[model samples]
Target: MTDKAKKKREPIFSPEDRSNLRWLWLGYLKKRAPWLGAVLLMILIQGLVYQQFLSMTESGLRVIFESGEVGQLVLVCLGVFFLFAVRGLMSYLVPLVTVRLSNEAIFEMRRDLIGHLMSLDLAYFERTKSGEIIHRLVTQTQQLGVFFGLATAGAVRDAVTVVIVSGYLIWKNPILFTTAIVVLPFIIWVMNFVSDRVKQAQGQAERALADYMNGIEETVNGMRTVKIASQEQVEAGRLMKGTGAIRDLMKRVQTTQALVMPSIDLSSAFVYVLVIGGGGYMVLSPDFDVDGAGIITFLLGMVMVFDPARLLAQYFGALQSNLVLLDRVRSLYDEQPSINDAPDAVEDFDTGGDIVLDDVTFSYSEDQPLFEGLDMTFRGGQVSAIVGATGSGKTTILSLLSRLYDVKGGQITIGGQPIETLKVGSLRGAFSVVAQDIVIFNNSIWENIRYVNPEATEEDVWRAAEDAEIADLIRRRGDAPVGPKGAQLSGGQKQRIAIARAFLRDAPILLLDEATSALDQATEERIKAALGRLTKGKTTIVVAHRLSSVADADRIFVLEAGQLVEQGRHDELLETAGLYSQLYQAQKKGYDGR
Candidate 1:
């Protein structure tokens, strides 16, 4: 790769990376220390028992050949059986403990990841794909648990077994054992080479999988649009591209893993051959000191050593493959939320004071400014309306008030206190927003309304539903599921449900973003009355494209190209013959033409 390409690619974690992932692993270990300690103890006992079994087998053979004592052979057999029983129990307990530890750690980590994602600013969601986030939260997290289980628990057990078995071999025949283990360094070198490939392939595979998931998510979410546009083939082809990329990357990863395992096995077999040949020469030589039984023990130890060596090799390969996933997950955890509470944030918001937007300068991007030093105020317990053409910073103003995005310059205050000084939850809790785009979950209408006020009584929910003019429709559905994204409901019905939610909240402040735009004329008029009833004696800000809707508002603010061009009552603004008048006249002419 060129230097530019290398710089563009995100660097995967290496042993030398020394990132907070190390601390994350340490924290998990500390949290599950009891389970970890038990697993380690069990592994140690299992290793010791395995070594004892091998020794007892050798002793039994020597007793039969040299001592000719059947009774002693029986005792040796019984000792081996006892060791096998203990090893079997330890093996079961170790895995049991390790699984428990893994589950607990995965649970906590997932909870923390979800909570962090929830606390993140809305801007993050706007830029990120839901499918990608879901993959990290679900699939990668599970893989991380498996990696932890193998890397820490499985690796330690296999390592202990190899150490014990190798030590026994050296004690019996140092020269032969040393000669046999000489092939291990070559195996390590081969594994290291394969590991680098695995790491690179694994990262590509994860990205491909994430892309595949994104395609699936989009296709599923936009099925209606795809069908209406007759673009099934196009979407399928796009999805196939994602799947093909994933397939190729996975093949590379699997090929690397497949080659590594056999290479390690081949090297181990070669070492066994060397041990057998060398030990045979020593036993047959006149000057040799070791006997047949000792040679047999050395050979047995070599066989035992190979099992763990192969296991460790496999573990290492899996560890390399999963490290890429671990890095992705860790990077997500390290992300800092752009919006957070101030150090001295107020615990509560005084909703009685007017909301003042003073010289508020803001922009979504540096080149395209949305609002520049804009000033406005919504008096306490009064309904104010913002009217403008599309992309004139109407809804953007509401977003600013809610602190979904903070101002780039100047300040916004409520009740004579700067909004940044108020706790995010408390500030948001002061207002109930009914936005243009309503989000309805696959839940019953009652639950959806009660989501904003979980403590609300049944009567209170019904009251709010009636006030929002959705009670009759919900009564017909009863507790029926709304289907995914409220597919079972009509657009106007979904809007009414959202309004019902706002009514259930009954907060001191209200924000309506084209709240009744989806309704028919008759339904809109009825909802307008309900809204008037709902907004009585509350600070309300409404963003409407329909100029007639705000004719009765206490004050109307007209925006043109992100700047406030007119501010007054509806008739007063029309008499001024400004941007507001032009928009009102156009809308009135359109209505009259209809």
Candidate 2:
């Protein structure tokens, strides 16, 4: 194929293909032990019924030769009828039970996958796209249903049937039965070959699909902005490119999977033709005197065995893909959380909200440092400010206190103990943070406020909302929907709801990253007053490029190029006439029209 043609083809195998389908099968079966027993009972009943049919055939022949009464023949026919009826009823019941069981298992598995994703540390989310994580949690797990139900477990039942039928065929005609059995291993080898390719292609396709889905999510989420900015065509072009790649990958995967079935069918047909032609010639000529009727029954048994074996064979490819899916799942399952509770981590920690960072250095990447040699502290029950230009590590300092990332060097202690040694939950429980870009869910205003503390009563929620000055806004909603991210509300209103949530959390430590940056001057003044009162008994750390916002802080630290260059009370820093002084003077000059 040409490069263009090859590119158009979908991938066949995925990393999940290498996953152990046997485990997926065994685990699911173990979960559905009751249903499996029912299916087994049905199988046993059917086998006995089939055996009775054979017996009836022989008995009827003898009766005809002996000229038995017509009543006896009628009785024999009724027995056969009853057996078939019972078998059909059991067959129906088995599937109904197994299907229900499998569906419930899938639901449980999906729920666990979602919980697993949520348990992952924030760093994993930072490195992974929202869509990719969602795809694994939703789409990939959805694909496992067929594998869990009809493919894996169903494969087991059909395998048992094939063995029983093969045994019958061998007893009736050893020569033909041996030949069919001998051909199975070769057919399985070929199926396994195709299965390997399917797994590899599917993995690539899954990744491509994740990329496409991510693009789609971004576009949908930003559709309004894209339209207003006249970037629709640009976005559409990018989506088209992504969609095209996904299409190509899927095509290759489907083509490889499709070929396996037909190839196996052709192999089976060739074997059948050879068996019939060779068997006839041998029986007609010399030593072999195989009875024609017995041969017919044996052939019928072979047909029954072949269908299930063929089904099992075709499943090799699906099993491969399912394996890959599970591996991806297990990868997530096996991950160690970046942040976890320490053995002796603090509980109900009462530190007067003092935070101390001593010679801390940190980096997201090995070679690129976000901050270096940062020493800072916020006094208990005091408002401290960090001011810096963009990328000056202001936010990085807040993150350090939150313990979002551990320092690469030096120690950060809370209440005279290394932060790492303290229980992570206990340490984090002490801080309430509101970032520059606030997020609100599509929920009732009351629910959003209470999100910080689910156990918080309605009275507590209302009190927080009132303090944050959003009580009236929420009351006006009167149980109406608040659109996603609070799009239905004004920017200032949305910020207040976020504040309400943080207020309700009632942590001893507060980190506000430009919390009031979006509000008008009048609203900013009101919120500032409220926040000032709120932080009176808490350690408050504020980051603001707006010098006026930080002027009232007990102490202000100026950061530049990942280093703290200046620190002192606001007026004292101004007297020093350094970086902080320069910023204050510039803002003052801008205000005075000098």
Candidate 3:
């Protein structure tokens, strides 16, 4: 396809996208409509009082010039003071209400976003960077709250003020008002043009910020690797480049804003000059019978009109910037999780039975198939081992059995029922997986074990820890901090803590994925003993790298390039001299040479 064709095919905003934004905005307003309505009423009252101040000024001047009674002059002065007081009070209260309402809306949005993120499938996290998600949830959501709460309200209030003041000016002196506003249309056109530029600049700035955040996130996450490789200078240079790009984009947005404010001021200044010059001629010339008070009132009203006009221009620029943030927030809300429960999905499942994969076909992508029409059965209440080299589909089998990813073709059954029909939470709860890549939180050992079962008693925790052969270590630590990612513990200690968690879970099905691949010989032997007891009654599937670990299993399945080529017990497979026998012999030779 040509570049032009591809560009045309790309969608900027579909009908559905527009609908999502409308729905999001309506939802935000619905939650705080009462507070917003009160704010609007206050702003309206303030605008009316502001107009009263202009009239009072005219009346007070007329009273003094005509040498009216002292009482009448005092009354006019008091009325003007009262109007100013009310306007000042309303200005303060409106902002106070707006800020509170905006904070509440932001809190609700954050809570919902977190809940939505939790509902997404595992594959979403696998493909997306954590920093990007964090940026959307934290920075972007905050901007939306501020825009909706403060900027939207301020713009509306400014617009109302401009309309009221302009109406009064036009009512008092139509010819002068019309002459002053002749250049308004051109000023509006310029502002609209600048608004588009601001929006474009804001979009670029947000993208650059995301990139800068990603650079910082990657550096912190891989700090150990960077330090060991002596690449601090390299990482620093990369981050500086990202920061520079963000700074440049932000400067463009600020430059646009600076230009907009001056243009608005210059436009309003021209209108002010015209009104002042014309109103002066009428009051001073002997040809026209214009009173001093009347001419002074018209000039004051014209100044009032320009005040709101300038405010509205500023609000328009701020609104344009916020519109970009709103679009980003709407996009996040529109994302739908790829995996969700079926409409008629079962809510309860019985986990006791064989796990059977019938002619399963699967792959991460279409171009690179990982498994093709494979079949296998893991019998209940038995230890079955899947031994193969790296990338031989061992971990993939375990993932499929757990239904983390559904098969591209065929079906998986547990306890004589199709796994797809089972409830997702209950199906996953059936197994306790202990993998070599253990994840330990920075918490107490006791708390880590109890994470599997929050209601587990202290005695129960101790028993599980003892079974995993880590009770002594826990007792010695006695609730010492585990540090970040269990930095306080050794490799074997971390694995044992994971084992204790699985034992505490007491699930009916178990999966061990290279559970001892990185441990020393003595530690592996100790963990092996605990595993034997743990798998005695449960249906266990072990993915082993070393053939020696699964030599005593009831049966062994050998996989090669996503295909299962051999299955039988230790002696039976050796006699057949197939792939299993070849792998066993190679490992045996290596062990003897060592």
Best by TM-score: 1
Give lDDT tens digits, candidate 2, residues 1-594. Answer: 888657533334433432444555565557677767877777777766665665565455556557677887887788889989987887677677767777887788778777777677778888888888878877877777756665665676667777676666667667776766656677766776677677777778788888888999999889879989999999999999998888887788778778766766776776677667656765676787764444545555666666777788767667766767777665677765776677666665555846889989898899889777789888888899999889999988877776787789999887666888877777788889877878778988888778889999888888888889889888889777688777788878778887888889998888899888778888888787778767878888999988999888999999998988999988899899999888888888897994
lDDT of 1 by residue, 1-594 (tens): 888657533343466334546756686768677767778888989889878877887888789779999999989988988888998888788777787788888898899898899998888888888888989999998988877875667789889999988787777678887788788678867777778788889988988898789889989989999999999999999999888898899999889888877887788788878877888888899888967887777778777888777888888788777777878887886677878999999877679789999999999989998888899999999999999889999999989998999999999999899999988999998989999888899999888889888899999999999998989888888899999999888889999999999889999999999998998999999888889988998999999988898899999998889988899998899899988898888989999999
Cα RMSD (angstroms) for every candidate in the order listed: 2.6, 4.3, 3.5
In order, what lDDT does every prediction score?
A: 0.86, 0.77, 0.83
Select the stronger candidate by TM-score from 1 and 3: 1
Worst 10 residues of 3 by lDDT: 8-17
Better of 1 and 3 by lDDT: 1
Evaluated against the true structure, the overall lDDT of model 3 is: 0.83
Residue pairs in collision within model 1: none
Residue 106 in model 2: shift from native, Å?
3.7
lDDT, residue 185, model 1: 73
Candidate 3: which stretches are off by over 4 Å?
A: 1-21, 68-77, 286-296, 472-481, 585-594
